[model samples]
Target: MKIGVLALQGAFYEHRKMIEQLGAECIEIRQLSDLTSNRFDGLMLPGGESTVQGKLLAELGITEPLRNLINAGTPVLATCAGLILLAEEIEGGEKPYLGTLPVAVKRNAFGRQLGSFEYTGSVGDLKDFKMTFIRAPIITAGHSDEVQTTAVFEDKIVAVKYRNQIGLAFHPELDQDTRIHEEFLELCKSFSLNK
Candidate 1:
């Protein structure tokens, strides 16, 4: 299946490489007008500065289109700052999120970028995956009925799945494991088939 990576900013190129390595067509989306239904089977919002990314989305007038895409059952895999963008609410900031997932987020909860570290945890479909957090946010809690935690760090939920949306608080692409990407592809397949 084809996957679209929001290339607005941050480490989106790395996500593109990872997806392409899995033999899937990867499309780099720079603007809202590039968001066409036929271009990809799923979308990946990469890790970046949430405040900047949020402003960029609003400036480009893509907030509603993206929300509509999620509403229409399009699979979305968001990481790090992308995770913040997917939250229903964000603490310590006024930036509004996409509110696609039933969870709250706190940006830079793990300390500054220099305080980043590598942590290993188990997820729902995959276990013992190594995750790297660079100024990552934390998924404090989620709705019991809709949450499927893939991993956690220091007792805080770091990775979760709500419906077709997968939110991760670390940079999985920066690591050697492909399980997360594979899981995302599987979610995309399920979403495309309307499962």
Candidate 2:
């Protein structure tokens, strides 16, 4: 399967490495032309500055197209700032970006970079998953019924899934564990076959 990792900002290369390590083709999506040249089976939006990524997505003319892909059933795995991008509503009045996932998010819910920490807990069906948070954002409690929360930290929601989109407040790519990547690829493969 071919996976596209948005390279406009953030820890995109790490996601690329994980995708390749999991035996899938990885494509770095840096421009609109890149999407035209590739029919990505899946996508990865890595952690970074949400503001900068949102700006770049607009300036690069990729915002709508990418959102269309996600909405059209192209599975996406969005992490941290990426999670903020996909959120339908962002708390504190930050304008939503893609709005493909049916959820609300709170940016930097765990403070700033210094507030970052690691947690090993259940993510979806993956038991004992290692979650690395860096300037993370949390999926707020009140969201649409379509959103199925998959992971939580303390008493706060950290991850959720809606349709073909998987949004996480932690950086699964930063950790050494391959379970999340493996699961994503399987999801992509399943989607590909059905298409």
Candidate 3:
């Protein structure tokens, strides 16, 4: 399977490495041409500044096409700021970016860089996985019946899934575990089969 990693900013390389380790082709999506020229079985939006990534996606004319792909059921695994980008609404009145996922998020809910932390949490049926949070956002509420909470930490919703889209408030790429990434690949495989 081929996976596209949004490389405009943040931790794209780490994600690419992880995906490659799983024997998938990893494409770094840096420019508008990358989106048009390549076919991706899945997409990974890595942790970064949500505002900056949003602005760059629009400026590079990659926003709509990427959104269309997501809407068309391309499996996406979004992490940290990527979660904020997929959120339909932001706490404290921030403009929504892609709004592909059906969750309302609270940005930096864990605070700033100094507030970054690591926690072992239960992710769906998987338990005791290491979650690394770096200026993460928490899903305060889910707005769609299709949306399901996948993981929780400190009573806060940290991971959610809506159809083929999965959003995590922590960086699984930074951790030693590959369950989340493997699960995402399974989603991609399922989407490919259905298509």
lDDT of 1 at 33: 69
Which window of 10 residues has the lowest lDDT sum in candidate 2?
138-147
Kindly list the per-residue Cα lDDT of model 3 for residues 10-42, writing each as its tens digit. Answer: 999999999999999999998989988998899
Candidate 1 lDDT, 60-151, residue by residue in tens: 98888888888778899999989988898787656566888888887788899798998776777577788899998998768557788778
Model 2, 1-195: lDDT tens digits are 999999998999999998998899999999999987899899999999989999999999999999889988999999998999999899988789998887889988989889989999999899999999988898875467878989999989999988899999999888789898898898999999998
Q: After superposition, how far is residue 13 of candidate 1 from its true place, in Å?
A: 0.6
Q: Which candidate is the best by lDDT?
A: 3
Clashing pairs in 1: 123-150, 124-150
RMSD, each candidate, Å? Answer: 1.6, 0.9, 0.9
TM-score per prediction, in order, is 0.94, 0.98, 0.97
Candidate 1: list runs displaced more than 4 Å: none
Off by over 4 Å in 2: none
Cα RMSD of predicted structure 3: 0.9
Would you list the C-alpha lDDT of every candidate in the order shown?
0.85, 0.91, 0.92
Instruction: Write the candidate numbers in order of decreasing lDDT.
Output: 3, 2, 1
Better of 1 and 2 by TM-score: 2
Clashes of 2: 0
